[model samples]
Target: MSFDLGLQNTRALVTGGTKGTGAAIVDALANAGAQVIATARSIPADARKGVHFIAADVATSEGCAAVADGVLAAFGGVDIIVHVVGGSSAPGGGFAALNDEIWLRELNLNLMPAVRLDRALLPGMIAQGSGVIVHVTSIQRALPLPEATTAYAAAKAALSTYSKSLSKEVSPKGIRVVRVAPGWIETDAAVALAERLAEQARTDYDGGKKIIMDALGGIPLGRPAKPSEVADLIGFIVSPRAGAITGTEFVIDGGTIPTV
Candidate 1:
């Protein structure tokens, strides 16, 4: 079953749209009839039709500038901006294991792209008096895994705070700013990680998945969420049906945070 999200004829931009949750979001916004411009460092080999692709590494100032220029030149501006380009490559042991460079890298990846892009594109939205921005944060902001993902968690926490502050400043101007925090999504990378854990533990696939869930203090739903699930929620949030919503962080973690 499906419902109209009222995104027809809108222009949208999705960063990191080549894979995983970002790819899912590109598909969702496009399927809902939005003219989607998906930006990544590289284009996908199996890229689909009806979605425009741009190659730019938005972790830097120049990349964000290129994307803003491209979108404005092509479509004047976008009505929806979904910042999905975030991940941690830092070798994790704890806070002590992280150096200044590692912490800065994580912040650049998880927080600054949205900050830069928003700064670049928001004037168009403000002039037009309407837009929606969604930042893809992580559940780790609330449930930090100190041993492995402390840097990632800290970056996402900053992003959440930034999103809220942006929303407050812009909502009165007709721009909606929201952040989506997802937990334990079953993306390809995550599945591969689970598989590696399984091999190390001499366990099967389900057991490997269980190992991850156990590490997260157990997802009450007993499994990870699909990327498409996160995409669908985002679809609704950017639609007219969610017009009144702004400056909120929606958690889609399969009950992983363990609190209200």
Candidate 2:
């Protein structure tokens, strides 16, 4: 079960590293002996030791470029870049619920950061002739939830397609690009949703959770995954041990995605 990454001295950049899955990935990379530069709009004051926190919003092209420059200046060049900074800004609505602004915001938040960062940093990785890139996508790309997150699903679908194309373009040059699609991660967001639903339904938090699960067709594992579980998959995918895993999607969803 040991991935045996031997990541000592390897430099990595993890976007959205202030909380949730991003924080978990940052911790995982640090534990594997990699020097990590974690970026977010604002870093937590009580952030863990050994991670260099950089204040930057990857949603902007300028911010992405600045982060890339800062990391290169500090670490010379990164061997791994984990794109974990995306999410939907749109509120709940079906197709008509999403306006142009919402569509643009979701695309920028969920898709553009990685595209911008790759444009800024992949050359360095290609020049070095070896690097790993992991894109954190969502299961929604395949299993679209139109009632609440149609725009989000569309944005993730674009991201998945872009990642696959980018991987094929870069893998021949000694850089590996892979994607991780997670389903129903147990994060603060989930907790908030549960609380909101509980109050609306006049039920307990667990009851709200059951309602959510039923909506998702019941997660086969009977629970959402922890952030650390997704992080573990990310850690392995970016390691040398997973060199042959480029241009593929790894779904860590507890069988929530029914398709083969």
Candidate 3:
């Protein structure tokens, strides 16, 4: 048997695509023959080839507009958009540690970018009568770490709900919207953090990684996922092969959530 994504010549855009999971998604789609446009606040010197790079923050209204304008001016519209820009800088210490400003920042980073970009870009897709949207959320939405990532978790939860609502509103119009919730992904940054933890704990890198995994209530699969693994799932979700899949959340957590 053979499997094909049928992404040839398809125009796609990925936010936060300069690094980590976003970069992996960019590569996956491009390798599948899609013409990918990727965005970042600053284009790295070693940015990947085979995809157009747009420099935009996407975490602010102005930045989202710039990205939308650039893509529209160039491609008129995109067949697919994978929202991958999100993170938190809020201080850890549970609820009281976060302020209104921090809460807004989390929302802006994790939720609003997807909302703004979808609003700006969806009209073109609606006009075309066909498109796919994948919002990269986090398992933290369901399995939140109160002390460390509460705001991030809340924002992802909002994103998940928004994704479902958007799909219901747009699926009849020929747009497919899906949410992807990833668990810990072993990216380069994660590896570096593990190394730091190892030094602090007087342990090896594996032991350090184990410490973090154990804190997640233990991943039944024995380790966190690879960035490429998440990207591949997104690649398939946006493909014609997944035409009937929409208005749903796919959790790639290596069974870390520990719930049915």
Candidate 4:
């Protein structure tokens, strides 16, 4: 029930850390006694205590370079890097509905930022001979909700593959690369969907939640995960306690993904 975790005084960078799952991870890292720098295109109304905010558009190469410079100048290099910047704006209508621009945007949004940041920062980790990189992917990669989020799912699949390949090359150098895929986390966006579903079904909020579960083929344990719950798992992951874990995809889907 109790472990030191050994994360005191370490530094970390979390993309899209202003809200949702990313904010939860930022808070958890700070709670575990690590210096956390959170990056987003704009500043949040209230950046959490013990977390530094850097305004940068992480979807571009320029943004990644600026963040790398800022962190390198501030902390020399971080002990952890958590890539939690991803979303989908692709329209609904299956793969046919998706256009080149939408696909490009989704790829840049969900994958390239992490790739750019890693290229800019992994050298520092390699030099120090240790670091942990956690990519926040989605269960869509495996489940593929094509009609609604085909591009997003495809990009995440690419990200998962990239994370695994990078880990294979870096673990020997003491850099641990891993991915966390969540299914329907209870963030603001998800809440909005539940509200709409409730309206359509003319039922209570819990009814809407069930509708979502059913759409996903039913989550056996019954509900989506809270942001904080997922953060707790991530907190343990980047800590020294999970020193041996790397090149793996940890799914926190409440048993939504039923497979080996």
Cα deviation of 15, candidate 3, in Å? 0.5
**Each candidate: how many clashes?**
0, 0, 0, 0
Badly placed stretches (over 4 Å) of model 2 are 1-3
Best candidate, TM-score: 3
Residues 1-260, candidate 2: write the lDDT tens digits.
87579788999999999898999999999999999999999978899888898898777888888898899889888899999998776677688888998888889889999999888889999999999999899999999888868888888999999999998899999999998999888888888888899999999998888888878878999898999999999988888888788999999888998878
Worst 10 residues of 3 by lDDT: 48-57
Q: Which numbered prediction scores highest in lDDT against the true structure?
A: 3
Off by over 4 Å in 4: none
Compared with the true structure, all predictions reach lDDT values of 0.93, 0.90, 0.94, 0.92
Model 4: colliding residue pairs? none
Q: Which stretches of candidate 1 lie over 4 Å from their true place?
A: none
Higher-scoring candidate on TM-score, 2 or 4: 4
Q: Which TM-score value belongs to model 2? A: 0.96
- What's model 1's overall lDDT? 0.93
CA lDDT, candidate 1, residue 60: 90
For each candidate in turn, the TM-score is: 0.98, 0.96, 0.98, 0.97
User: Residue 97 in model 2: shift from native, Å?
Assistant: 1.6
